[model samples]
Target: MDSRLAQHLLRRLRHQAGADAIDRATGAGLLTERRFRVAGRGVRTFVPGPLAAGRSEAEIARILERHAFAGSIARDDLPGDNDPAAVPEQSAGHDRSKSLDANGLLRAVRRSAEPLGAADVAAMLLLARSITMNTMPLGEILEALRLPAPIMTITGRVAGFEKTFLDLLEQGLVLPGKVASGEGHILSRDYDIRFSHVSDARWRVVVFAGTELDPEERERTARQVSLAAQSRYPILGVSEDEDRLPAVLRQAAGINLVSGPLDLGIIRDTMRAVLGQVPEGDIPHDHASALTLADLALAIRSGTSAKRALAVLDDLARIRMALAAENENDDGAASGKDSGRKETGSKTGKNSGRGNPGSGSERIEPAVPTGTETDRFIPRVETLSGYGKAGDWALDLKEDLALWRAGSLHWEDMSTKLLLSGPPGTGKTTFAKALCNTLRVPLIATSVATWLEPGYLGDVLIRMSATFAEAEAAKPAILFVDEIDGINTRGSAGEWTTYWDQIVNRLLELLDGSARSDGVVIIGATNNPDRIDKALLRSGRLERHIVIPKPDTEALVGILRHHLKGDLDAVIATAPERETGRTDTATADSTEADTASIATGEPAAAAPRRNEPAE
Candidate 1:
């Protein structure tokens, strides 16, 4: 290692283990060193010595376990005797010294709008931190920071730049991530990285937490960690979130390098990185302050038009403002402290609340009506028609719910999330309402478009999250997400890519079984199931896809009877006795056509009461 790299590693070691730890290691000769008299024999500066002459690899490896160092030392940099019993070194995948075209990099930078964005700067911070304070291999960290060619093409077009941003990242940062599976996926979860290395003499385990894992998965992860502790290779604990790991693993984590909240500079740089430039006008400081890196990633996309990016950002800013206000309101409510602002409907719209999709003008309507509304004619799953398999699914859910409520069945065993797909007016919304009645739970009705009504990306996200929160808050509830296909699939490279990407990702997080939505059954209705992001339908989410096909003739007849409250059945039974005159063929044809319209999901006219005779 060069002096600069050695000094860098030393500072990182000091940060991770403390000054005394490094001093103790040096005194023990674990860190290779050479003594030279700078001024005189008495005044000497101890510089990093040639590894070939200093400590053996085993001694260096012992310090790794003793201090619980998270950063890896390049094996080639260490000098070790050909002792077969010594600990094995992990192979650094590729050569870092390979020549990269500085001219090509400079050319890309000059063509780019700005040097970097919040993501790149954050990547730099993450890279530095991972090197200095964590157990992650430097190669792995660089792999995570690497961007795709398209992003490089956009971000590299910097207006004016002199030097390479980071010498360490010069080769790999512009390239795409090569290993995006396993550990790479974990590293890519968030911009802020906080991980620690736990080790014995033989094995190393990098423990971190954040993402939710079920009991079985947790057991599997714990077993993996234990196995890694018995082996030479280091294994990463399955997570990127905090307070979600098993207690045994959590206790063993030694040192972490956590990231702080983003600032205007990072946010601007992120925009520059993704969009090639920041939009004109000042970003709302409050919104910018409240933003997470995920939110920023969701707001910006590579190859996005500057106009769309600006719009998305503006929307995000407003959403943050509204969310901050809403949070304040919630806090006030909790503390019995009154905020002068009386609770109106939502900041985004009038029809926002738990299970309340609002009257007439709202994008979504309440599936299960309340009180007197429930007394009015509304189909229950038992009486509903035309749903076919979806109805059977609902009945099964009702049974499972009964068993669940009786504490005879586990929530994990129940199929909670479902995707209902059919053409418009196939009574998809009605199924949700009927299911709500069948399950006897409140229905929180929402849609992707409804979430966007606030006209800000941030507000839409807040609303989306709020809807899920509302559903979760009301356990034994059904969250009816209508027009779910409106949440565009993540495959599009269009103007609204970031918008849809954020929405889809947020929905995935909410719909995830780990998000504490056990009793909140999610029924996503879409006219176009193919338009949905496939991730949404993955296991543990809306995994079951049931089609609510257009009603058949028999199903239409059942639907008609439902609307008529059995009055139509009475008419059919008594028709043989009363219809002595010849039936009009045209009139009969018209009646059948209207019935087909109802089957096609056309709104049906109000029927006479069961007590009242048909007109």
Candidate 2:
């Protein structure tokens, strides 16, 4: 049995068999569990299990049939493989023995008779996970489906996703604000089950989208999301920029249903659903558009005939793609021309130090040198020492990053932001760079000192905001903010009360600023934790505080080894000789001094030998 065939069998069984029958088969040794390891963790998947071990395809089919899983089971449906043990079980049940209603999950999304395209099915699957995880109430999904022209607006809010919406809109395949009907359209729905106690059974669901909103509007939306969550509503968020949404909104959103590219079939169905008919002539099925069903409805409502809209959209798509290709060509040529200089500069540390942070809206990569002379010699956190818990934390972060990149972990779930407190020589700043190298992400370093270089309160605040904004732009990057204690305590500001309060307040906002700091692993280094604003150290700001200790002798040795690099082997080989020499010198000198003191009828003198200094 192949993995694919095993998956196919599981899929068919879910449709044909009852939960009890499947459970019985599994319990009766007909099925065995296979474990899949991901990021040092094992995930159990139940497939044909032991039944496929020694049986032929026909025999397995018969076994399934006996279990009342299927009728008229065909041998052709079951794939043949000589090695039965080779196929791992498909991922189905976890630790739980019972099956969650797969059919019910299907019906929850497929509210209409129309077939679901890839994007639709993907959306449904994400929504189902949200419901099952108890993050979102299923009733909310139902209600969202009932709404007419739910807004799935196109905008450039998040970095990577901005291009997606922009590209589609420029091609006319996506229309902005079409489904909104002058009101917000949150995907998933709420159903008014007349006096059924349906909504009361679980939690209330609230859905909202602010992808197209301006900064001020998004703030208001964030406030609304926060209020809704405070009111005990389980929010299901639908946005293209899920990561960039306000921390409050993101925290509230149990299920984030991001809109993906729409296939031609879905587009056709949407056109028919909105306009009563699809456009005449062949519609391209090649590329998926970012357009949603609401976009189609809006386009229809905008007075353009379905046929004419389709023609115009297709034409614009061709032109957009052509322009995109041209732009790519230009970018590639420019990159090639600059690659040598950039690489050389990185190696030589010529373009190092705090990079130009005020450089327009373009992504500014902070050029903090990561405690190394050149890029090649920068040691990872694993190679460092004296960081105490911070070192262990960095290792854990490294592992989590691996899991995150592998899609087994989510960003919000990762303990990425932390405050590092230690005296000046404790390598707090160094730990940040080491963590960055260990995680293999870019480093964006800024400090309270740098923020004040511009003098004026307004300019300082702008610099502070820009640093955070830069970090967000270079997502999955390490943002190291040094001298965080410089953002003085609120009440202690005294005469500069207004200035320092504003600065601290701004720092707090940037630390948890949703879209601006999302995806950034923030490391705030401070020499004095007491001086830091209490609110800054509270949960959701820099929640975790790790005090980096001064490197002990062993740590110092390790640091030496790391810096020594090629010289480490030679140093290690001669270490015993040096230790032996020092020991012999101390013993001989102590004996001579004691003998001299005894002969002179005086008390033995304290002899400082080897590495010790004479007092």
lDDT of 2: 0.50
Alpha-carbon shift of residue 485 in model 2 (angstroms): 0.4
For all candidates in order, the CA lDDT equals: 0.50, 0.50
Question: What is the lDDT, from 0 to 100, of the residue 377 in candidate 1?
Answer: 56
Q: lDDT tens digits, residues 232-350, model 2?
A: 33343444444334556544333333322333433444444334566654334222242333333334432456687677556655655576568656656766675742222321000
Q: lDDT per residue, candidate 1, 1-615, as tens digits? A: 112333343333223233334444344343333456656674522333333123333433443443333333444433345643233343633232232233332222123222233344444433332232223344554454342210000011111110122221222232221111122123332232222221222222232222334444665656544543443333333322222445455445332222223334344545654566765443433344455455555667766765676567668777866876798678557555465554554332112432112111112223456677335456788777788888898899899999999999989899888899998888887788777777777777877678777665444554565465455435667888888888778859498787777677767766763334467788888888998888988888889999988898667766775676535445544443323353564455445555545444464444444345657
Which 10 residues in a row give candidate 2 its minimum summed lDDT? 347-356
The parts of candidate 1 lying over 4 Å away from their true place are: 1-378, 513-516, 566-615
| Lowest lDDT 10-residue stretch of candidate 1 | 150-159
Q: State the RMSD for candidate 1.
A: 23.1
